[model samples]
Target: MSVEIALTPQNPTHAGLSGRLVCFPHAGGAAERFHDWISGFAPVLDVRAVTLPGRGRLMDQSPVESWPDLIESIVTRLQPLADRPFAIFGHSFGARLAYEVTRALADDEQAPNLLIVAGPAPQMAQRDRKISGLPRPAFLAEIEAINGTPPEVLANTDLMDRMLPALRADFALLETYEADRASKHSPLPCPILAVGSDNDPQVPFHSILGWRHRTRSRFECRLFAGDHFFPFTNPDFADTLFDYVDDALNEHTKDLHRAG
Candidate 1:
């Protein structure tokens, strides 16, 4: 698949950016999830949001069910753009995918400068209750419990109907991800930043801190005030996010200069 189809550029016309920020959305979320985030980093970075199969413009296509296939497709499509200094940012389920993608690109000449994951930790042991296989009603209830879905979407039955298939598929992917299998690999060389909420029921504070184990380089975890979807819900999220990303990008540029 072409990278054009796999990514939706948020600031295509912006020029002279030194780095790129590739964003991956939460489960069942489309590229639009990062639409509001474009303005923050557009001046310094080329921002592109991932468009997974079975959602948004690719709604007609079959959702990728295999983890390895999904990762391979993303990595393959991203290779062309990976030539530049870039950062990978993902939320919730997307965070897990970002980690795997970073691992796959670890040896590339222009590997990601940083990896930013939000809303979930590297540990999957906490999710003991598998809701992906539950019937429709039960599945929706569990999704609601996560508090990631907006109230407007939950209230609209027709929209909910259209969204269920992708939701179910994504949840199944999350449920099947084996943490033990992932941990066997060497830790990433790039720095990692984990963002999470203090009151998030689905992912606790300790869980957010657990990401420190996944990186050989620097690891920092930032805690905000909100529920699981604090990335979108918290008022201070945008400023805080941009500040961290700016520092990382600056450091990456300095490293490239030293290497040259």
Candidate 2:
């Protein structure tokens, strides 16, 4: 028997731009967390952040357990947005999910123009598991150390109680993901832009370099000055990302002119 997967659809907000950039959040992240960055991408790219189940507005829904299931759901939901010049930007767990989703789309002969894998290594070995097996206090301490969890969320016990389950569920997904050798490191036709932080403990420098083998298209890697979640801490990270996007688009234009 075949299982049907249901994905929560978010209405795309009008951005008055021709291109679309679909962003996936990190583990335990909500769609709203990316609104500011989306706004920044609005001048040149129509930014739409995926709202996955069991978080934010979809808090009541159960989180999907398996990676294949999650990727299938996302690919189905995102098919409509593939018509225009589109790109994907995913961080950490979201980066892995984005890579899987991109592969699935490519299998169907639908691939994005650009893929930005930020804050995560491509291979499973490089990924770390710190939060999955931790006790409650230890988990909270880990969150605190990351500095990504908001102050209000940390201060309010009730809010933390409500959010913890979803966070844990996401962590479970990351911890349990088994790498498929058959699907490992297939070369993509589109250019890939890798973003990493100098201080990110979860992703090693060599692991980030492994991404080069996954794509035959042009590849660029940039190391920003900050920790694991550099975009959150550094004010200039968004500007740097935008600059890369602009350069990629320009290069695409040049390629088109040459082909014409």
Candidate 3:
């Protein structure tokens, strides 16, 4: 089944930038959420956030239940964009999905310039440990505890009623994900920049550092002072991200010249 993916560029003109930064949203997020971020990364990096089905413009569409199905759908839609120098930035559940998509691209001999994973560890953890399957009240409590769910959304019962199902569905997808250990044998040939929040309970510093084991390329981890959704709270998070990207780009260019 073809999942109707809504791909919208935040800065289309900036798509011609030196490199592309494909931004994948966190769970229960929409591409439009990052519209302002594109401008923050302009001139050097173009940002395009993926709008998955069952959310945003594709809200009416049914969300895919399995990881393989979701990854396949995303790769199909994003393959064309692979022609240019690109990197990926995914948060929370999106981070793992981004890694899977990168692996898919690498298998097809289309590796990106860099991989940025935020708010999640590199490898998949046990599905039985998922807390998203709790009852509605329990789940809402969990969301509240995490502090990622906006106050407006939580206060508005009507909006919460509408969004809760999709949020649960997304949680189910993340909870049930099973990692393919075989793919780790040949990790993508690209640098990995793991970003973790200082207080993100879901992603620990140790787990983020584990990403080093999966890459032959340079691996670096940065800790930001915030919760699970650091970027949302800290206005300067985007600037920090771009700084790392700028450094990576310079090193890559230098390496190319040296090789030449």
Candidate 4:
């Protein structure tokens, strides 16, 4: 409902830094997923993670089912933080959020300096069929097959039950988002760094490379070794992520100097 409930700083002590990295998690993920990243970029970037409803600290609230409403909420929350140089990093479902949020912010003439999208294309990632409306068992099976959920969690009925609401809502959001694919929107003005993995089953190399077309500014794609969850499992992920953030910020500085 408010920015305070949505955006959480991983390292609040490092707030007011010249740059910020706002992170969005995949479906069924909590902001804590980015906790480890704070240590790697805190010295230079104020890392903040988004906590959507029906999960994490917002567990008491119902998950947002509308894609437009979710994007509007995120863009509104991000507005105050965009006062300083900032970048947005999102994975899977969050990648879509980051792109839409960036587009909305850019419309307000307050775009981020960089947009880092991982695990999906700038547009909706292709899906075999709509699973959100499937029967409970079938839906869970489909989610398990996607490999986003851990095997142990799938085995634990209690955990799965607790996670179902948010998971269902998020999947529904994706189902509805498919309708927007044919809609026309302009490319973003800021640079974009699209990260993917060599062996990601959900997102192919071309899907990651697709982000290049979403930006009018610079675009780069980096492939690593792992699956869709590479950002959490890959050892070299932090280094590569921070490196791009640094480069983007440096480039922004150079542009500012030229304009001054």
Better of 2 and 4 by TM-score: 4
- Pitting candidate 1 against candidate 4, the one with the higher TM-score is 1
Candidate number with greatest lDDT: 4
Off by over 4 Å in 2: 1-16, 125-135, 142-152, 180-183, 250-260
Ranking by TM-score: 1, 4, 3, 2
The C-alpha RMSD of each candidate to the native structure, in angstroms, is: 2.1, 3.4, 2.5, 2.2
lDDT of each model, Cα atoms only?
0.80, 0.73, 0.76, 0.81
Tens digit of per-residue lDDT, candidate 4, span 1-260: 33233667446567556678899898877787888887767778888899888888887788888867787888877888877788999998888878888888999999999999986664646465889878889999899888877676689898788778888888887777763462356778999899988877888888788778788898889888888788888999988888778777777777888999
Per-residue lDDT tens digits of candidate 3, residues 1-260? Answer: 67777777545567456667788887777887787777666777777889888778877777767778788888998898876667888888788778889988888888778999885554644455566778889999877876656676789897787677668877787767655463356766888998887887767788778777667888888888888788767777888888877777666667777999
**Candidate 1, after superposition: displacement of residue 96 in Å?**
0.6
Cα-based TM-score, every candidate:
0.92, 0.84, 0.88, 0.91
Reference-based TM-score, model 4: 0.91
Per-residue accuracy of model 2 over 1-260 as CA lDDT, tens digit each = 12233332333554345567788878767778687876666567767787677777777777666777777778887888887667888887778778888988888888888999975455544325557568889998877776546666788897787778767776777666655452376798888888888887767677777677778898888888887677667788888877777666666667767999
Report the error of model 4 at residue 205, Å: 1.1
Tens digits of per-residue lDDT for model 1 on 1-260?
32223687545555577777889888888888887777656677678889887778887677776778888888887888776678999888889888889988886655688999985555553367788879989988888887867777788898788778778888888878887676566789999999888887888777778788888999998888988778888999877877777778878789889999
> In model 2, which residue pairs have backbone atoms overlapping below 3 Å?
none
- In model 3, the Cα lDDT at residue 52 comes to 84
